[model samples]
Target: MRVKVDADKCEGHNRCCALAPELFDVDDYGTATALNDGNVPPELEEKAKLAVQNCPEYAIEFVKD
Candidate 1:
């Protein structure tokens, strides 16, 4: 599975980064960004999904391949 973060929708909450720092990172403004070029590691997919679910602004999404 792949993950996508809509920077436009993000409110710099940092929840995604907090949930999976290995998979996500926060930009200078604190918006969540993918650390792996949008590729979600199989082991971290659940955490990534949780990040997506926990995003208050609905900024994260999973794109299944």
Candidate 2:
């Protein structure tokens, strides 16, 4: 599974990082950055999807490969 973040659509929400810190990181300014270039480990795939689902700004997306 792969996760994608639309920085342009992000609203500085840290939910993604909060949900899965290993998979996502929040900058000092509160923007989110993907730690794995969209590649998520199988164990963390669910959390990644949860992060995408919980993003208030609808900035995160998950793609299955």
Clashing pairs in 2: none
TM-score of each: 0.91, 0.91
Question: Per-residue lDDT for 1-65 in model 1, tens only?
Answer: 88889989999999988898888888798877887688976898789889989999999998866
Candidate 2 residues lying further than 4 Å off, grouped into runs, are none
- The Cα error of candidate 2 at residue 24, in Å, is 0.3
Instruction: Give me the runs in candidate 1 sitting further than 4 Å from their true place.
Output: none
Instruction: Provide the lDDT at 59 for model 2.
Output: 97
Clashes of each: 0, 0
What lDDT would candidate 1 get against the real structure?
Answer: 0.87
Candidate 2 lands at a TM-score of: 0.91
Please write out the lDDT profile of model 2 over residues 5-42, one tens digit for every residue: 89999888799999999999888888898896889988
Shift in Å, residue 46, candidate 2: 1.1
